[model samples]
Target: MTRVDFMQGNIASAEGALAAGCRFFAGYPITPSSEVAEHMARRLPKVGGRFIQMEDEIASMAAVIGGAWTGVRSMTATSGPGFSLMMENIGYAAFTETPCVVVNIQRGGPSTGQPTLAAQGDMLQCRFGSHGDYSTIALAPSSVQEMFDLTVKSFNLADRFRAPAFLMADEIIGHLRERVEFPDTVECTPPRPIREGMLPFEPEEDLVPGFTPFGHGHRVHVTGLTHNEKGYPASTDPDLHERLVMRLIEKVERARHEIADYDIENPDAEVVFISYGVPTRSVRQALLDAPEGLYGHLNLRIVWPFPENLLKKFPNARVFLVPELNMGQMAREIVRHCDQPVISLPRLGGELHTPQYLLDRAEEYR
Candidate 1:
């Protein structure tokens, strides 16, 4: 348990994963995110962990799913195009209830438009990338420090919910050089219990089912198809399918307060600024240096779960500015959660949102 200095965001992610007890990694070499794999390759073995560079991102995702079944906390990192290749396997991990982490350092998309550049285009993809009705937890980091902390949180969430947790970052957050303190004694959230002699799909008080490792002598049979409490395939029962889907959704949906991030800089302002990821850094900086009297800034680090309850407290706001890298992926969620009109400032594909651009937008709201 040692802390390092002068680390890139990707390296910090690797260090965080290791600190969270992640012992297995499988990924391809993709830009902005490849450094995560590289760092894990060098360090995983020293800690009695395993690292593999698969032929492609598909195989990489599959490997981690298998690793998780073996009772090892695992992860995989890739960019936009590589992330697409991992969708099918990601769905597999979800249905099987595999506990692992997926890191997507997003870049210009469609089909590798800009490999080396940063883009927040994967916001929607992380939510809808996998098929079927499944709950995926995606965490976005605005700074290098968050890159470390959220990576650890992502692993904990994955283990807790028995679902694949995503660390969705853009190139800026992945490549940014910053000093991040890595805690030697990392405090991680606890996952659902897999007590011996209990059914895997049995819901605890929180509505989340417990997960157990394969070959643990509990007779668990995990499958990508619909399954029952025993983990054996059970697609024939409609009730079983409905129970599984509802439980998966409720597991994360019910814990929004535990999962969501909301910061209120000015609690008494009429106007609020809403944004996530790297753009939030600019928004905060802009508000800090504003010409004395300006609007309040509500920066969100957790995009999913929407924080519906917390949003009900802001009814007096005249306008809410939703600034993101895409054409309002988060704006859609903001509009759904708020009664006021959400002004969307969308920067599509490989572009960064600047403070001046946001300040100009904020002025219009006034």
Candidate 2:
């Protein structure tokens, strides 16, 4: 039977991870995200899973990557400061092609700005925080229910691409309480197993190699340094290094359209509001109260690789209005992909844009 209950967003995310077969969790307690670790501690052991509270975010990230190589689905959760501490390991996970999920329940800050407040300031950080060039998938949820749905999707994406996936949530969604339906079962796509006689890092047509877990007798060597198809470090070979890095990026970039996920309403409207995360709440309300044909909304669930093609969906669009908690991080991407006038509505200090505020902005373009 399906179970329905009123739950907080962080709790729902934990439940979703459990449903998605996450057997290992290594996290450091951080505000707006500690509940995720707390829930996992209480629930993982009951299901015969492992949950460890690491000394800090950096150690937590390393533990999760180690857990993934052991053939278990692993994850970690954090807020802004913790997220920052994990950047080095995040890059390591990307270079090694380790499949894991990192959930960032965003809070205000450059340095511990507001622990108990909501902010979407980390939108860009998740995409480029780690040094070097690589591509990873990121999903943003706007509600308590999506906090569950998207967390499951993050695991699926991680395993599918053999790369780290991020759940970029904010404090508002992390703490929000709402009704969520727990399905009896969730379908999971496990990693493709390495076949005999195949090179460890050799990729198939999709550019994603089959996974060879540790102790699998596959003779695999995992390293963050540039490597050859046989998984041996080849950093000295310039051409080979280029090929390795390019493949890592193209595996996700070429599939951008396939991984793209969003919601489009009033596709023919001249004025449009593009948003994600908590700001999406205000956009929904503005649409509901606007006059017929007044404006449209493009709500994004997946934000990385910036599905540039989605801009064409609004053929009649004269202007695109973007509202975010950051200082126009994603709005700048919109401007790059579109010829239409792009306006950014930025809100900071841990507050959400009111419905009236969005509607007022829409009127300017209309």
Candidate 3:
């Protein structure tokens, strides 16, 4: 097989999922993200994998979780409105500790605001859109290569951590065509199997429980309610509820450092730019034009658990400038973590900030 090819980001993502040993795909076809599903439909069967077009995103998410319990790596792709629909079941996946990947090719939306245009409006949604207090693992890809690399990484993280993982790409990355160099073999980590005698949801030291594949004599009860280690509903017990909720959040948060993927440059510079996903493209261009040691940069690959510790790497930074596609969804997270003044450069519509646009804004403080 050719290891390098020019392909769209969505197709690269599907190839990544296939490369990661994802044998089952279930999703509703939505704009900007539909190509991922389309590609999977054609590719999965050739790989002896299965693909299903569900009634909607909710069912798509449910089917993914169900397929995962059968010991197969499962995934789904959707855009903003569809992403919103999946929130409920996504919570169920989190509460149940199901290892699966969700690709959200973000489009502008409060309610279908922009179907084809790109936006990072759903960054906060992926982290907190689902009902309540569970932490999530989300990866954002800036290029076609990363769309593949991060999709594979997302699956590894999901299996290693035993939680729902997200490939948080936007429409810009999804539809863009670029050269992607595939690895001869990508690293893989299957979900840790259940021990001889352990409850379904009982966690190990890492706060992640081993997975029990459904079928053949091993049976595990799975429920969305606050459950004990046995996977039975225990919503009535406040103590059990607290313990369960805390563990769900803590498993990812506790592993934040281990889960964090980012890049830092010119750590001693006075003016800094922190961004993830597509916005980082602009940051890179801005950096190239600036003088040596003129600006610091922090680009995140794994965003959720947010990686606030990366901020402290730039000690001399007087202002942390953030340019995002939405109205500063992540800027809010930055504000709480850093003492430095954070300037939120939010582009409300689908427009991306240009390199010149960012550099000009920095002149005041730079």
Best by lDDT: 2
Residues 155-268 of candidate 2: C-alpha lDDT, one tens digit per residue: 999998999999999999999999999999987999888767779899988999999999878878998888998989888999998888899899988888888999999999
For candidate 1, write residues 1-366 as lDDT tens digits.
Answer: 556587789988998999899999999999979999999999999999999999999999999999998888899999999999999998898777788999989887678688988888887777777887777888889888889999998988888888898898889999999988877778776565576566877777777677677777666777878888777788899998998888888887888877787677765566778877888888887787776547777777777766766665565678888788778887888788777888888887666778887778788777
Clashing pairs in 2: none
Global local distance difference test of model 2: 0.93
For each candidate, how many residue pairs have backbone atoms clashing (under 3 Å)?
Answer: 1, 0, 0
Which is the better candidate, 2 or 3, if ranked by lDDT? 2
Candidate 3 residue spans exceeding 4 A from truth: none
The superposed Cα distance between candidate 1 and the true structure at residue 323, in angstroms, equals 1.0
What TM-score, computed on C-alpha atoms, does each candidate reach? 0.95, 0.99, 0.98
lDDT at residue 317 of model 2 (Cα atoms): 96
- Give the per-residue lDDT of model 3 (tens digit) for 1-366: 548899999999999999999999999989889999999999999999999999999999999999998989999999999999999999988988999999999998889899999999999999999888999999999999999999999999999888899999999999999999998899998988877788889998888888888984667888887888888877899998988899889989988887789999999999999999999999999999988779999999999988888898998999999999989889899999989899999986787999999999888887
CA error at residue 157 for candidate 2, angstroms: 0.4
How are the candidates ranked when ordered by TM-score, highest leading?
Answer: 2, 3, 1
| Alpha-carbon shift of residue 98 in model 1 (angstroms) | 1.2
